[model samples]
Target chain A: MITSPKVETKNLNLYYTENQVLHDVNITIAEKKVTALIGPSGCGKSTLLRCFNRLNELIVGTRIEGEILLDGKNIYQNGMDVVDIRRRVGLIFQKPNPFPKSIYDNIAFGLKIGGMKNKSRISEIAEKSLIDTGLWEEVKDRLHTSALDLSGGQQQRLCIARALAIEPEVILMDEPTSALDPAATFKIEELVTQLKNSYTIIIVTHNMQQAGRVSDFTGFLYLGKLIEFGNTNILFTRPKEKLTENYISGRFG
Target chain B: MNIRNITDKFFHYFFLVSGVSAIGILFAIFVMLAMNGLQTFTDVSISQFFLSTRWNPSAFGEPSYGILSLVVSSIMVTLGAMVIAVPLGIGTAAYLSEIAPPFLRETLKPVVEILAGIPSVVVGFFGIVFLGPLIADVFNLTSGLNALNGSILLAIMALPTIVSVSEDAIRSVPKDFKEASYALGVNRWLTLVKITLPAASSGIVAAVMLGIGRAIGETMTVLMATGNALQMPGSFFDSVRTMTANIAIELGEVPFGTTHYFGLFAVGLVLFFMSLAVNLTAEHFTKKYRRYRT
Candidate 1:
């Protein structure tokens, strides 16, 4: 089955002041699938993920050329509200970044700011979001406690639930498990696979095994260019490009 | 011993002596205040000294050692200064940390620092010459020197300390928390009030307490600007005398060791405890905030 792209980029280019970071890249991210971007340090994979939500523009003197479309609408067009576009897309950072607030309020922050006013309804959505991320049972008894008191793994999951509470259509994870232990990393990978069934998932990772384990499609980025992109199994086993094969085979990163 | 080793040992003991002498001076001052004030404490019951509102220590017939009015004026002036300084300080800090462009922040920060560098006597002089008359004219008062003038001057003096320390606290809030708030699509103002301010709450609290300390212990400005009235202040517009001003006014040329002289020492002791309490509270809050910073 051929699925239409949920997000598409056309000849996308990015620059920080005078320095170019991404160049002439075209890619399509399909709906309801996990697409992983793999690259070395400063390879621009994280920068590309930030582009989806226009987060890159936060830095002073950042300039973007070409179009990034979400569901066939140009996100960068004049008159398109940046805040509204950001609400439709959620982002999870490399480290667990829960607010210095109670566990329940952490999830409810998005709901409240997004204008969901009913008290009971906000709690209802917060509870559901926690359950969806498999954190409801562990945290149910102490939802009023500070979120920082949670274990590192639990904090990361709480962050995921925080993103999910807004019910965004697309979720972006940028090395979400890089700070967790092996066991915690495995649990997050499991959650990402489960999350793929409902929301379009785009992840940027440095761990090859994580990309292979959780992703359906993979793109290997090198020096700000997409070297190869294809089915995950084929990309790992029989890469089409020399750089992709070298990277997957543990050659120079 | 070799010259280097001898020099190192000499320097180490020199530093140790200097540190010990500084602490010894503080202990000596405390002992002096207690010894000198002890006579006054016995002459007038402690309750009478603290509770009596009429503070006439040099009356021809009978002297009254009441300091309740001084305490009340000190508190009123400190609270009034906090009312003016706290919001202005924190608002300027937030603007410097989050809103202002780099060039403007750089330009304005040093201006606040210079305000702090101006001597308290000079500030008191400014109050006497400018702020006092202006306030008197505006309120149609008999004289310009009053609690209101004192508070306005002290607020200006406290601003630099409060704004600089608070700016550091707000800026020290981790980048990740801000990014997370922005990722949630929350606006800049909401994120500032809800996330950054709460995270920096303890530091901001410590800053305010320290500012209060500066306002309460300040002697020159309050003494010059408050008209040194011994009567209890009926309102902010009325001329008032704070504890600092009382000690300052009586410390000079009162016959040494007379009950009146000892009474001033007792007031000095009270001032000491007040500043000590403020410093201790500030330290407690700063330590509490330090734990979460990591």
Candidate 2:
């Protein structure tokens, strides 16, 4: 497997004020493949995912050192446009956070923000994205209705559609199914499987079984350090690190 | 009964009495206003009382009880006050909640609260001595006491309420909404204007409504700053009298039980309804805002 990485982090370190969270993490994420980050609570898995899109900069006192390169361009460089970085790498949160807008507007929002002004083009992109997320049929007749009216699963799918509508190269999911039920989680897992062929995905999930089911590569983090990084099947079964073994076996956090 | 049951009964009766007394006071005021003001309808027709622009309570032969001018003046002053206050208040709130550094926000919030605590009479005095004279000079008016003067003072008085409530609303917008907007690559200004403000709109609307209620019910400031002239204002600078000003000025000198006194009471009743409408609107919007939280 000699595929070049789509995203690479070189000695990435992140801090919130004086408290360091992620320390000297280095990994290369292959293109059009799902890479899952698994760790215990407060282990900085979500923080790492947010760093990909520079979402962590929103919090005051946050500091990041080292490089996060997207397509070989260092995103952390002074001249790098953060908005372009975010547009290139879309993110969805753990909880479904659809705007309190019409269902149609939810998908249209990203397009509009990305400067897609033509109404017909926006509608076409919105419809295609919704269909890709498999929500168009159920909501086609009621596109004008409030997005809040949708069920939690539908809303999560809608959020995915919103992220996809921007046509990003990579998609980051921060425990996107944790708040959902098992059925909805399965639906999302299946959707992730289908989405990976077209977009590079980096998912942060606590559910180990889900990481195995949906991801190609799995990275196990412990106390802000990358403990193990390998194929999902190999890491789950034959982890090289003791901490990874204990964490995966549920022996200890 | 046991001692616990007896104590419970006593407390329940006490609570009931307190609640009834509060309601009773409101009932008593309504009854007083109705009993005194209803008779004005006999001397002056309902249409004339509501529609006529002329208000000459001490006319030589016949007194006119028309409050049209007063109502118009009240509306003009309130509208003017809102026009001045809304932008300033909301802008201050946005800056405090979203943009201002913590040190600046902490220093300014208490200053706004203290502004709310200033006595209306003191504000009225400032309006008469300073604001009125300044306005008169700037606009080339004969007198500074006018709707504009009253509006400026009322706007200052209303600022604290609007800023505090709107700031709270802006702060309470879930961090997730902001994150989502930011993840979409939208800038802070667009995020505040589009997502944050729209999400917090119900609360902000309630804040503005409450501010309007305060401006409409304010008496001393308007009475002292506005010329208290019985005229429908043609412009913000024109001398005029608000409903509260009319009631305050007449209630002091008009003999009790006279038609003049009753007319003032009628104006009070109308003002009460206007405040009630404002409060109900505020309440409605507040409830609607809460529905968005969950």
Candidate 3:
């Protein structure tokens, strides 16, 4: 099936102070589909992911010189509402970073911040978000307990639920399972595949098999450049770039 | 054991005694206070000692020794100081941790520490000369020295503790939490107020409790500034005395082996327990709310 590009970067170059971190690069991410970015450490995968929501601005002296468009609108244009951009495009961190609040509050925080005041509607969305992330039954009874009490996998899922509760059109995950064990990683990988039917998912991962298993479209980045991009199955099996082949075969990261 | 082990053993025993001696000194203080203070209850009925509002020990007639007024003065002054300090201190802390640029935060931090390090007597002097005159001039009171003066001085004294500790608490909240809030599309101000502040609430509460402890135990400033009136305090403008101020003022001139002398010790005993209770409550909050701090 063909999918329209939800987000696309045009000759994106990012600099941290004097050091150029992301070279002139361009890539298209599909809507309502799981797009995985795989590369070794320091390859600018996470940096590119952060560009989608302008989270890179949090770091001082970081500069972006190119346009990152969401639904064909330049997000980096002057006077663009960053908070609104981030609301439309949410993100999940590598380690599960839930608030110290209870499970219910963790999910309700975004809705309340977005000015949703109807109590019953907030609860309904909170319950639905939990169900979407597959954590409802396990956490339903303990909704008021601290989110920190959940296990690592459960905490990561709660982060996803929290993002979903805000109803963002795009969801970005930065190595969302890097801190989890194998079983937990499997659950998250499965959840990522299942979540693509509704939200445009962009996942940055270092694991080759995870990228192959979960993503419908795969982009291999190397040395701050996109080395290859294609269907995940075709990219895994067929050779288009020597660097992609070399990195994929476990010769070196 | 080798020579190294022998040296380690020696240091271990030495440190053990060193640590134990701190508690020993505390026990000695409690024992001394109890020895001197228990004698007062024999003549000063518990009701008369703690209940009555009058506190005249040297009356030509039957001396009335009620500490209720002093207690109220201390609490009211300290609470008023807290009213002034908590918002300002926490605001400064939040600015340092979340908003202020690096140079501003660095410059302000040492200023707060210096504020704390200034001698309480020096603060008392300022209270009497500057703050007292300002309060009287602004409010049109007869005398500047009052609970308001005491509170202003105590608030200055308490600001350093509150700002220092709450700043630490706010700073220690993981950057990840702030980032997470930003990811949810909340503005920076809302994130700091709703998420960052609440996440650091445990440490902030502990900081506020410790400020209360500091304000309650402070003696010199209140003694020199609060006019040391003996009657029940009616308003913030009314001259009054705290238990610490009372003990400090009378303990020096009281004749030896007198009930009045022992009465001062009783006041000291009560002040010590109040400070102890405030500190313990601070510690309790720190421990109880630290579970989610990870």
Docking class of 1: high
CA RMSD of each candidate after superposition: 1.3, 1.3, 1.6
Question: Top lDDT: which candidate number?
Answer: 3
- Native contact recovery (fnat) for each candidate is 0.68, 0.63, 0.87
My TM-score estimates for the predictions, one after another, are 0.98, 0.98, 0.97
Candidate 3 chain B weakest lDDT stretch, 10 residues: B285-294
Mind giving the per-residue lDDT tens digits that candidate 3 earns over A1-253?
A: 4468899999999999999989888889989999999988999999999999999999989999989999999999999999999999999999999998999999999999899999999999999999988999899999999998999999999999999999999999999999999999999999998889999999999998999899998999998998898888988899599988999998889
Candidate 3 Cα outliers beyond 4 Å, as residue runs: A1-3, B1-13, B288-294
* Residue pairs with backbone overlap in model 2: none
Interface root-mean-square deviation (Å) of every model: 0.8, 0.7, 0.5
Restricted to chain B, the TM-score per model reads: 0.97, 0.96, 0.95
Q: Cα deviation of B115 in candidate 2 (Å)?
A: 0.9
lDDT string for model 1 (A111-150, tens) is: 8988999999999999999998899999999999999999
**Stretches of model 2 off by over 4 angstroms after superposition:** B1-7
Among incorrect, acceptable, medium and high, the docking class of model 3 is: high
**lDDT (tens digit, per residue) of candidate 2 on B8-45:** 99999999999999999999989998888887776778
Mind giving the per-residue lDDT tens digits that candidate 1 earns over B72-120? 9999999999999999999999999999999999999999888999999
- lDDT by residue for model 3 over B120-211, one digit each (tens)? 99999999899999999999998999999999889989999999999988998889999999999999999999999998898999999999
